[model samples]
Each structure stands twice: as C-alpha cells, then as structure tokens.
Target chain A: MSNLMTNYYEAAAVILFGIGFMNLLLAKNLIKKFIGLNIMDTAVYLFLAAKGYITARAAPIIAQGTAARVEDYINPVPSGLVLTGIVVSVSVTAFSLALVQRLYKHYGSLDLDEIMKKAKKEEKV
Target chain B: MTAVNYIQNIPFFSIFLAIFGGIVTPVLGNGKTAQKVNLVIVTVIGILSAVLLVHLWQREESFTFMMGRFPAPWGNELRAGPLEALLALCFCLVMALTLTGGSRFLQKDVLPGKQNLYFTMIYLLLGSMLTLIYTNDIFTAYVFLEINTIAFCAIIMAKGSGESIVATLHYLVICLLGSGLFLIGISLLYSITGHLLMENIQQAILDLVQTGEYAFVFAVVIGMIIIGISVKSAVFPFHFMLVSAHSVATPASSGILSGLVLKSFIFLNIKMFYCVFTIDLIRSLKITNVLFVFGLMGMVVGSISALKERRIKHMLAYSSAAQIGYIYMGLGLGNHEGMVAACFHILAHAITKAMLCICAGGLIEASEGNVGINSLRGAGHRNLVAGIGFTVGGLSMIGIPLTAGFISKLYFATATIYSPQKMVITLLTLAISMILNAMYFIPSAIAIWSPVDKKAKIPKPSRAMQYAIGIFIVLNVVLGIYYAPIIDMIEIGIQLLES
Candidate 1:
C-alpha cells in the first residue's frame, strides 16, 4: 500500500511538471505563468517529501522519555531540504509579484506581447 | 590536517560582523546617516577580511567550520578552504571599491529617501555572496542564493525607473525558472544519494561509477546539475534575460551584478563540478567538450552583439557575456594552468568592468542621460578623469599588454595550446574576435579622449566624481602591473583543489 502511494505521488509530480511546462510555453498571461511555476514547485516539494518516507516508521522527532530508534524513523534530510526549498520558492514568489506590480505600472498592461511591442517602439524612437 | 585544525577555530567573526552590520543598517539609522554608517562598516569588514585572507595565505591552512559547535557530515558547515578565502577577499575588495567608486553618483541625485534601503540591500547582497561561497551544504547554498536574488531584485527596484521595473520583472521570471530547475535537480540528487553532504555524495557516486551499477541514473543526475548551473551562470541558451536585466539596472547595481553576482554563480558551478563530481566522471561525461563549444560560441556571439549595440550599457552587458565565456573556456580546459587563468580573469574582469560601468554612470549623469556613442562625441575633454577611467578599462578589456586582462587571456590561450583537444586553433580564432571588441570599444574611448565638440557642451563632473574615477584608474594600472601577489594566491588556491 505504501509503495502504491509512493508511485501515485511520483505520477502526480510528473503530471504537474508537464502542466507547468505547458503553461509556461502556452500561456500569454504573466501571472498565469507564475501560477504554473508555483504549481510545479509544489510538485517538487511533494516528491521530495515522499522520497524521505519509510514504511512503518514514525516521524523523525523523538517522543518524550523514549529512547531514539534510528530504524523506525524516516529520513529527515529530504524534509529539511524541502523546508528550505519551500522558503526559497516563497521568496521568489514574493519578489516576482513585486516585479509584476511594477511591470503593470510601467507598461500599463500585463500582457507580455504588448509590453514587448511598446518597448521595441520606444527603442526605435 | 594539523594545519587545518589550527586555522579551523580562528572563527569567521569578520564575516559575521559584515553580515550582521548589513542586516541592521536600515534599523539603526536614518537615510542620511545610514549610508555613511553602512559604508564605514562595510569598509571595516573589507579590511578585516583582507587581513584574515592574508593570514590564511601565510599559514597555508584550509578547513570547514561547523556553526554552533555542530559536527560536520550532519550539522551546517562553513567551509573556508583556500578558494573560499580567496573569493571572500575578492568580494570584500570589490565591494569597497564599488562603494567608493559609486559614492559620487549616489550623492549627486539623492533620490529623496531610499538611501537606507539601498545600503541595506548592498550589505545583504555582499553577505549573501559570502555565505554562498562559504557554505558546504547544497541546501544552505540555495538559501543564500535566494537571499542574493531577492536582494538584487530589490536593488533594481530601488532605482524606480519604468525601464528598470520592466527589466526586473523579466529577470524575476527567468530567475524563478532557473531556481525551480535547480531545486528539482537538488531533490533528485537527495533522493538518489540519501546524503546531504557533498563530499559523501561525491564518494558514493564515485563508488557507484566504479562499480558500474547505476550508469544511467548517474548520467541523469550529472546532466541535471550541469543544466541547473548553466542557467544560473547565464550560459548560452539561457542568456536572454541577462542583457536587458543588467543593462537597465542602476550603474552601482550593474557593478555588483556583473562583478560579484554572476561570479557567485560561477563559484558555485566550480564547486559543483570540481568538488562534487570527481575528475574522471567529468571527463568521461564529455562535459568539458560541451563547455568548450558553448564558451567559444558565447565569445563570438557576445562580441558580435556588443559590436552591433548602440547603447553603452547594453554593449557593456554583452561584453560581460563574452568575458564569462573566457572564464568558462578556461575551466573547460580542466588543468591547473586553466584554473589559475580562470581565477585571474575573474579578478581582472570584475575590477575592469566595475570601473567602466561607474565611469559610464558618471558620463550619463554629466550629460543628463544623453549618452549614446554618437551623443558622447567630444565629451572626453570635458571630464578627463572619467575619460581616463574608460580608456584604461577599455584597454584592459581588449587585453592589451601590461594590463591584468592581458595576462589572464594569455594564460588561458596558452592552456588551450596544452589541451589534448588542440584547442589552440579555437583560441586563435577567438583572439581575432578581439578586433571586433576594439572596433566597438575604440570609438567610445576616442570620444572620451577627443576634444570637446562646441555643439555638445557637456559639463564636467564634480570633484567627488573626479576622485572616484581616479581611484579606479589607479586600481586598474597598479593591479595590472603588480599582479604577482594575486597570481601567487591563486596558485595556492589551485593547489587546494588538487589536494
């Protein structure tokens, strides 16, 4: 059952990645693309978290008054890495959103095509 | 090991001070006082870092420091090997110079109350870069990388121009993709290796490769790592974002971006390749050949783009891309001499590029933003010191004899001759591209030095501007001539890699 769950998680990750890449390529809306990116990031976090799992194991944290048993504990490294990854993704998301707001103000349109056209026209002038 | 231990407990107090000082600058003072206080603190940190680096150089020790007395292979570790120390030294010196070099421009148009925020970002950028280089854990490195990226975005936004905003957004989009790819790659590595420690993972990979048990997985893992780093370094196929982003940033920000930020990525790449992947695996994977091809292409294409560009900053940005190619090409050679040449070029390019950008900033300010090559015609006589800075920096970029750039290029070219692949022919062809560099750069140099046009009426910058230009010019010339000490230090760093 645990192996089946792990397999499902892996498939979900791959599907999310595919969807993200598609949106990145197909979508014209800047914010939509950012949303796709966030989705993809979430998929990666899930995948990493799943990889650290151990069948019939408890959480990495040691219970009070109980001696630590390494054999029954899930690997903590990937979880730690995922935590850092989540923080990094959040930071990127915040900064990119700020940049998007600025872009909206500058080009007066969030459409990438319109902004490029306007920029090119200004350059020519 | 004995030498390592003696130096291990010295403590990286100076680095901590610099980082803490940067984090607190915004909270401690008002706008006017913040800039002065930050500058003083950064300068002190720079001096202390240099002194520590000198001591380390003299002692010839390299070791990792575990934070809060945590043991390595588990807890967070700050590795201060010779290479890390050398890079830290370079960062401190460049930060000091850029702060001093850009003060005049900062003072001229006191942007009505963003001074404290600006210095705060600068400090954070420096601190992040130091941490990025010093950390051993890949995840910790990512944390610092995020800090660096956010700080850079903030710096770009601080300029508050419509163009800067657009460029910053573009940069953010591209960087997010790159960082996303990077995180995915790290996750895959973690899943496979089950060890967060780089050295242990390297050993595991080496053992597996030797046993031939997981060849396919090994290839995929290595490919992911290379692709991730390539994006960060803004190598070919991923360089579209850098040109506009660097060009639109403020001159001081451009200096930091080009001189230090990109160098941080390159630093991480070197660590990822040399420290995390053994030499045999790298060679067997034919990654070096791929690097050579890309490097050569960047050298040619970047120079061509620079030649065609009309805007001064855009041209400089493209030139930076070309210079990055040179550094990578040296790395691809994968020899001691190649490593030395690459390290030397990093220092030379940082100083020269920063000086050039600062001078361009002064010119733009003096002319009230009318600074195309055509508009710059005959402005040289108006501001001779700025003109001299441009000429000196331009000469170095072109790799003229007696300049630091010359030695780096020459050494790299010689290394190509020694390469088994007979890269000498390619080096010769790339050297010819320097002619294209001269064609684009010389006109600007001449415009800076030629008699002022009666029609243009460009004004001279203030004494502060003159002093800034003078400092960079002196740096370019003095470093160019007296580069032996630096060369010696770099050689020691190369030896550390070999060990």
Candidate 2:
C-alpha cells in the first residue's frame, strides 16, 4: 500500500491504460475507437515518462560550466523512447484518420457495426 | 572485399538495401521498373544472406554488428547467428518468389498508379522483417514491428476495394492494439531493468531471479509480450480478424502476410522465449501451460473453422491459423526438440502457404474472379500449373508422405517423445488436425481438378509465375527428402541461440 502511494504515477498510468483499452474494445464508433487508441498510447507515454523522471535529479541536459555526474540527472533513454513513441503514435493516428475517412465515404457511417452490416449486405448483393 | 573479412557486414547491407529500395521505388515512376528493381533488391539480399549463412556455418560462430560507434549496451546492434541468417535467407527467397508468382494478380488487382507503391510496401515489409529477425535490441524490434504492421495494412489496402479497405481497417486496429500492448510491456521492462538490449535485460533478469525479487512484475511483463505477439500473429480466439484480412487482400499480399510476416512475429516470440526469458523460467512461470491450451484449441478450432469456410482463400487463411497453432503447440511443449519442431514448421508453412496463396490467385484469375470452391470446377483444367501447385501445397498441409508438411509433423511427433505429459494431447491434436486438414483440402484439390459441363476459356498465368510455382514445388519435395541436414542446422542454430 505504501508502494502504491510512492509510485502513484505508475498506478494512475495503469488505470488510464485500462480505461483506454476498454474504450477501444467496447466503443462502437470507429472514430471513438481511434480516440481510445490515442488515449492508450498516451497512457504508455505517461508511464514511460514517469519512469524516466526522478524527484531530485535534474533533466538530462547538463548546465553550462557544470561538472556533471551521471547520477545527477534522470535516465535519458526512456525520455528518448517517449519521443519515439509519440512520433509513432502520431503517424499511426494520421493513417487511421485517413482510413476512417475512406470508410465513412464508402459506408455512410462511422459506427463499426453499421459499417460491417452494410459491407455484409453489399457482399450478399 | 578481401577474403571473408566483409562477411559480417552482410546483415547491415541487406537491411539497408531492402529499405533503401523501398525509398527509391516511387521515383522510378513506372510500376514495372519499380518491380524489377524490387526483385533485384530481394535477390541481392537473398544471395548476401545465403553467403552470410555459409560463412557463419564454416566459422561455426555468430557476430554482432554495432550500428554506430558505441558498444552493445549503449548502441543499436544487430546479431546474426545461424538461425537469424537462415530466417533472413528464407524470408528473402519467399518474398522474391511471392512477388514473382503473384505479379500477375498484383498487376491486375492493384491500380496502375498504385503498383509502384505496393512494391515499395513490399520492400519495406521485407526490410522490417529482416530487422526483427536480426535485432539485438528489443526496442529496435518494437520499432520494426510498427513498420511491419503499417506495411501489411498498406499492401492489403492496395487491393483498393470497399471490402479490402474494411478489412484493412480491422487489421490495422487489431495490430495497433497488439503493438500498444507490446509497447507498454517494453516500457515496463525498461523501467524495471533499465536496459533495452536483450542480453543486458537477460543478465538483469538472471540477477533478479537469483534474488527472488519482483516475480509478479516479471510474470506480467512476459505475459504481455507473449499475448501481444500472439494477438498480432492471430493465434486463435484473436484470429477472427486474420480470415477477413488475408482473404480480402491480393494474392501477393495474402502470401506475404500469412507466410513471412506472421512467421517473423513467431520468430520474435521464439527469440523472447530463448534470449530474454530462458525456457526454464517461462516453464516455471507456467506460461507454457497457457500457450499449450491455446495451441490445442487453435489446432482443433482453426481447422474446424477452415472446414466450414466455403471460399477457397478463406479456407486457406483458416488453415494458416491452424498451422500457426502447430508452431505454438511445439513451443508450448517446452523442450529442446519442441523448439526445433517449431522452427522447422515455420519454414514449412512459410514455403507451402506462399505457394498455396499464389496458386489460389492464379486459379481465381483462371476462373474469371470467382472465389467459391464450387465455382472452381475445372479450374485445374483451365490452369494446370496452378492446379498442380495447389495440389502439392494441400498435400503438404495434410502431412502427406513426401511433402514438407510431413517432415514438420515428423519433427513434432519426435519432439513429443521428450515431454511425457504433453505426448497424448500433442499426438491426438496432430491426428485430428491432420484429418481435418485432409477433409477440407483434398476435396478442394479434387474440385478444382474436377470436370465442368462447359469449359471456361481463361488466360494462363505468366511464365514467371509458373516458374516460381515450379520452384516452390521442387523446394517442398527437397525439404521433405533432405530433412536430416536442415534439422541438424536447426539444432546448431538453437544451440547458438541459447548460448
């Protein structure tokens, strides 16, 4: 219980992940599902960023004229990873939106179930 | 250039060439030109990988190439052992052959303006697959996983139909979910171990295990990684999306997706099992039990689903799911020979399924775009080469006496001898799945060859396509006959992997 309080950020990230995951799974609207995906990605970023941060340490950048020690700063790798994750998430979101646009034009609906039914009807025809 | 000094650079060179080929393809402006370039790039990579494999075999060693100046822990690195080289070689060969054999359909199915982009996606897909096989950094693997996912969706969407687009959407969504889970898993791993390199992580994990600390977190991380990969590769239950996507994609796209992409993910899974978390640890964690149950279910349920499917491509897609079940079952057996069986099955399925998908495409073309099994009457008569190809692939899938599938099954059976607890279940599932495979495959094989009331006039596949299919048939027979050498190589590869 003390550990949970100490690592509150990670716990919050986990809760956010669960919420985003459930929304992505249960949402009927395609765009809403995509929004859920974005939220999930955000939760991951939050988790990663929180892991990279240390309470007492400074940012990875060293100040001018300062003799720097490795322990004086937070871990830089996870921060770099967060940046990469964001780039990936952004491109994926763009691609998903483009696909949604096409789907909407074709099916006249953003609802996944409706689109699926219409596709089935078209296949039958 | 001097002697064998440059052999170590082959992995790097092949990855660069594949990706660079994709980048330069659009500038070629002509689809045919881009295709020629892509084929050339793939063949070059194939030759280079083959050379590297031979070099590694002769020296009996593996080598790591640093991406920049930094050493292992701090730098991006690629490692090529016998197993990685073999996988790279086979992937290159499969990609080249898929393109060659399915080019006719590619040209017909994809738009004139979009053909070049399609090849670009293929090149990118090949590059990412090779990276996934060779990468020493788990994070590098994750990055390439995204590339692979996007490229697969692109190729599937290249079919440019309402149905194909819908299929792509579903595939993309599921793949994103898989990668999202995988990313979070990686983040947790990094947070715990503070290293992204596989060897370093393994070292940290070993120490942590000795101390008996963070066991729950460790188990959750491993579970997330396995489940993430399984979902992406469409192991049963999560396999519903695969049927629609593979069936709706073009022939080459389906072949690549089913044959190479899924196998690469499985290979990555194998790597994680061996390199990151030792098999003993995984067994102790009881993750193998979960995999075992899923594998059993997938074998029976996937085959049953395939039997129920009426469309030829849909059946083949379902069969792919069943074959995946076989690989997972082998992995779940949690023995040395079980891993060997799994690797061999990967090769068998990659070669056989690619040939099957391409042949199905040829038959569809010969039947004037009809996809139903009933409508394929006399398709064999119309396209004799495709008919023969499909027959051979089907027989291979059914574990017929002298096919690649038979060798894989033999290995699985031999592997089961080591695990007494799993023996009965493994053998029973094998038998049941084999029967189920034959029940659907044999009839479809005969139906295609069966006579029709009115003969349909259709164009034959191009010479390149026929030649590609012919080569696959020969490779299948050869693999079946020469199983001893390949099995030995796999054993050596596994030893190198664990070391």
User: What DockQ does candidate 1 have relative to the true complex?
Assistant: 0.62
Q: What global local distance difference test value does model 1 have? A: 0.75
Q: Considering summed lDDT, which 10 consecutive residues are worst modelled in model 1 chain B?
A: B3-12
Give the i-RMS of model 2 in Å: 0.9
Which number leads on DockQ?
2
Instruction: List, residue by residue over B1-499, the lDDT tens digit for candidate 1.
Output: 6854545643356557767777787786566577678667766766655655677778776667877756766777776666677777777767767766677665543355777777888888887888777777787777777788788888876767676677776666666666666777777777777666677678777787778876886777677667666676777656666787777777777887888888888888777776677766876888877777787777878889989988888888898888888887777787777878888888888888888888888777655577587777655666667677888889989989877788888888777766857476567756766887788899888766666547554456767557756876776777688888888888876676545
i-RMSD of all predictions: 1.9, 0.9
Clashing residue pairs for model 1: B380-B448
Clashes of 2: 0
What TM-score would chain B receive for each of the candidates shown? 0.94, 0.99
Per-residue lDDT of model 1, residues A1-125, tens digit only: 78557589776886887687566545678899788878878888888888888788988888799999899899887787778778777877777777777778778887888887887776667
